[model samples]
Target: MLGLLSESEAREVEQVVAAYPEIKSELNAMEDALTQYAVAKGIPMPADLPGRIIRRLETLDKDVPPGSTTPPQTDSGSGPILPILGFLLITALAGAIYFWFQTDELQENLNTTQTELQQLQVNCDQIQDSLEQIVLSLAVLRSEGNQTFIMRGLPDKNPGAVANVYYNTQAQQAFLDIRELPPPPAGQQYQLWGIGASGVPQSMDVFNIPQGDGINFIPVPYLADVSVFAVSLEPAGGSPSPTDVHMISG
Candidate 1:
């Protein structure tokens, strides 16, 4: 139909396609069908086919000889078709959908980022809890007339064991710091003793470090004028006096 028209007639045809919505819709639907068909049949469609089709249609629709529906070839196939933004849009859409399906790297990256964020949140919460515990302990360790007593392991039993006693000498209030120790059986616990200046070993408190942990904290009975601090393995309820299995003393 364009070939039957004069040069001026063809330019008029290109203008209509570039400026009209009806024409653009028709062009869009044609390519959409072609893409769907190619994918359904497991066939690869040339990436540039949509652009080429629009260019061809733009040229062929430029002019129509009254009641004539045929193309007329000229020196250049349909003299200078309009620049087709519709084809560019279709091309971009196709590329986006392809990447969304065929690329897992993007999804994997998103999942990894979420997992790391969760871990960081958990670590932050743990640090906050640890800070709260430290503040509580520091209040006692820094009280008026605070004194520290070190306990060393007994010569015959767990000589490697050690501890620190943080006590308020004035108030006789104390806390036990079991720094390094072995875990006893489920039915056995370790006991702390405060040996008075009178040389009498008084049971202070019962405690345990689960799973042979390196450290534990226990609130101890008042220890006014205590001359020694000691740790001994005792039955679950604890012994009334230092046990024969004393693990540490000072």
Candidate 2:
């Protein structure tokens, strides 16, 4: 009992407790001292002291084996589980990153493919338009044996402009060939007219020609006794009637 112990013994026990690296190892000895001290003093044990001794004993028991004083098993399988779980976590994280990069690459490729497809579609449309123009040009050249009229631009209005008219009398088709003209201003276009025997101009077709390379071929379904061919400047899509005389090749 601590109370029964001489002052030197009590001091010695305290010194031993202080000398130990782990305070948890002194719980049993501390409890023994408290019990002997309470009995020797003819006093009941303090309520707080039992609870404190139990808590300290529990802490020491976690690190010390039962029946023997050797330290408890430190390997609770936690070390192995941690490393394995960490490896699995890292693997999952890497897989997610790889998938993200792969998805981005696929999306970029898809966008590129879509752009190329759109350009191809535009090229196809242009090729189709050119083919139609070629077919019309061939039809006009085949009618070369028919009555051909050379309509020179009016020297006063357009000195450098020239055009040709091919009339297939057998087929009753008129083909117009404008060889020289200036480019129309923005929002304006050129229209062709057939002047008949009665001097009345009939609406024929509308076309646009680039500067320097001013040739255009247009086919007319109906051919009457046309004496002259003319051209006029109209709106972008042409008008029901000529707006102004830009160039007349007749």
Candidate 3:
């Protein structure tokens, strides 16, 4: 069809097409497809194309010797122009659909980034609070009248947990340094207790572990004549009496 075949090959193709009507029909369909492709790609074609083809047919008839089989050329009309316009419309619709999806994806990504930034801010605030607690605890420990005591974990419950209690008897200031303790159970917190000489437990402070890893330096109420410092796992706000004693120091 593209004039790529030799003379002998062209003759053979012509004979085959003549013998098979289905082959001729398929070749005609291929010519129409090529014409549509050319128009869609903006390839220019002369308006007098039919006239040029008729003249070429006349020349071919004269050039070919007698008794030689001549292959017929398929005529492709202005059928390709309408299909080219349809192709352009489909392309425009596809582009619009792609743009809508891209916009939705970008919006989702922006939402994710904003959520991550909010989490980061919350982490930063927690870090600041922890730092303030550490500074206050350090000041209390370095004071002149400060007394330090080591609270050992109960063997039955938490043998590895330990706490360092710092108290200033003159200033009535106290801080509990949690050196090694596992996180509390869900919906629970650690409660600090001050046991006086009378053997009654007084609730000093109740606190929770922050989200990330860090040493907790918590300030607690200092009781006068307190002989023992203890910690217990209790409900969120703490229990009046020691409900679950885990660590104790005198």
Candidate 4:
């Protein structure tokens, strides 16, 4: 049917088809089946294909003996089925491609949502930490055993600076509130000191001054037997003892 036979074999097959009506009808049926299969798989047929087939059939009819009848024609009812099947195949393929694109878009949206959720989680953590710090500062201020002291700036260093120190001896906790302070120079930080009766200043904590105007509450080490609290401007890492006292409270 596909002209794949050798020359002699082709001749023999043609002779057989001409001699036997049943064989001719079977070959035609097989050819039609193959054409339908190609259409169902979305292979396009040429526009002149029907005309070509009719011409070929007329040529074969001319070859038939004058007294012999033509072979029975197969039913044309199945002709519409192939085109319907081809349309369905094409529609299915289009639907599949559309779904693949939709899935890709959905995946990208999911990734973006996950990133936003992670950022929200980080914000929640920061808020929780700030709340905890406020609660601790309040506890230090309200405690009965807490000692409160007011620190004033030195006349020469920073006369405008002032702060409050809260020391809870019973709980061994200390907090400092900066009421007014200037921003430290680059590569420098503010250091807190706990001066005991021995006249020696113990290094407590070093911190950076925030940019805003609101008072900042900071936690510091609660050293034993301290009689005074002080703050100093020091290097990046604080010195062992005070280098330049900015504020003091006895």
Candidate 5:
């Protein structure tokens, strides 16, 4: 009804509204709100508003002679109440449409900005995690009198599996860094084993695999006369000896 929308734009809006029936309900709600507001304000709509205006124009035409094209004189009195009420209602509807369009545009922009910001936050978190891993690895490497061990999985079944161990004999500090290993089953767990010179697999500790790039610091009970280190999937608490074959060992 207003000239705010072009013909094509109005058609597009109509098509969109037709595609989503929910928009009809929203328009209905707006109409109801306006009706309720008019009722509350005790505003009366003239029943024969248009018919009365037309009849007055016809009377004026009859009063003027047929050949005479004289314009009607302006009445120096208060304007009709119906016209004033119609103007106020149209002005209110126009204002509502203006705000509605403005709010819709702002909401779309807000959604787009939020998506971009969330992506940026994910990237920042990944970068922070990598930096923390680097710092931890550097700290281990820079430790005094450190020893390193390479852990490899069984060649036949798990050729690609590998891990690393960092140990310092003087300070008696140890850490297991799992570089390549798959996640275990729900009930299964990974156990670290320290092999002694007499070919005995010592149960070091039981731990679950870390989620991301993380190192599990394990205690070193005996660093002396250690020959090999290994990891195996065992029951929850772990076994005294290597009940199952080693998944990764050196």
Candidate 6:
């Protein structure tokens, strides 16, 4: 018989232990309180206390009693089933921890995969755009009688550098093939211009030659007549007026 805990002490212990979400864990907390209470009162714990506790726990487990089940009748409030409930609480806590870590790992992996997929999509779009531009360029060349103009690079620049200009007299379109020309320096680009006999230059098209084998097409506006075609080096997007003539051809 355990009557070591005072009435007030027993009430406090019950309230604290019952606050747990799992009543089974509360049962174990009650057992610990009882053991401490007995020791403080100079009462030795019974030798068969563990065996009695296991037997009572087995009965309660078989019944699958509700969380609100009343404590088993005993001389004191402490019951033998408390130890078993504590073991069950520890097992549940361990399982919850394992699941939480597993879920976090899965989320991290999903985020990594999503990032990779987005990068792949961007690469695919760039490739598709390049292919479309190439197809359009070829179609324009085949549709008209194209006059090829070899635009020779100007002096003070790299020699042997040249660009091919395909002028379609009927369609009045110019397709520039800069595949043979070297890449422009940083912050600079090649801009095409239509040179009139009056020595005035009209903005035609401004474009860049891509890193490898670049080709581009520009629709030539009908200017009635033009003396020559010119290319100038300007800022990246191109200047409103020609700065320096890089190459010229008639």
| Cα lDDT for residue 2, candidate 5 | 22
lDDT against true structure, model 6: 0.63
Regions of candidate 3 where Cα sits further than 4 Å from its true position: 1-81, 154-161, 181-192, 195-213, 231-247
Candidate 5 per-residue C-alpha lDDT over 1-250 given as tens digits, one digit per residue, 9 for 90 to 100: 2223455544333333333334334444654564465467454423453354345334434554555432222245433432343344445555765565566667768989999999999999988877787777788889998888888888764677877888777767777877787877777778888877788888877876666655544444445656688888888888887766546455
Deviating ranges (above 4 Å) for candidate 5? 1-85, 104-119, 197-199, 210-225, 247-250
Winner by TM-score between candidate 6 and candidate 4: 4
What are the candidates' C-alpha RMSDs?
A: 11.9, 23.9, 15.7, 14.8, 13.4, 14.6
Q: 117-228 in candidate 6: lDDT tens per residue?
A: 9999999998887888889888876876667767888778645567767777677766776645677799998888877668889887677675644455545444435557
Query: lDDT order of candidates, best first?
Result: 4, 3, 1, 6, 5, 2
> Higher lDDT: candidate 2 or 5?
5
What is the overall TM-score of model 6 with all chains considered together?
0.57
Worst 10 residues of 2 by lDDT: 12-21
Candidate 3 TM-score versus the reference: 0.51
Tens-digit per-residue lDDT, 1-250, candidate 3? 4133346544444444443344445545644554575467444444554354345334445655666444333345443443343334434433553464466667768989999999999999988988886787667778998899889999999999988888889888887777888999988989988888788998888976545556566777778988788889999888878899999995
Q: Give the lowest summed-lDDT range of ten residues in model 1.
A: 79-88
State TM-scores per candidate: 0.48, 0.55, 0.51, 0.61, 0.55, 0.57
Best by TM-score: 4
> What order do you get sorting by TM-score, best first?
4, 6, 5, 2, 3, 1
For all candidates, what are the clash counts?
Answer: 4, 0, 0, 0, 0, 0
**Backbone clashes (count) for model 3:** 0
Winner by lDDT: 4
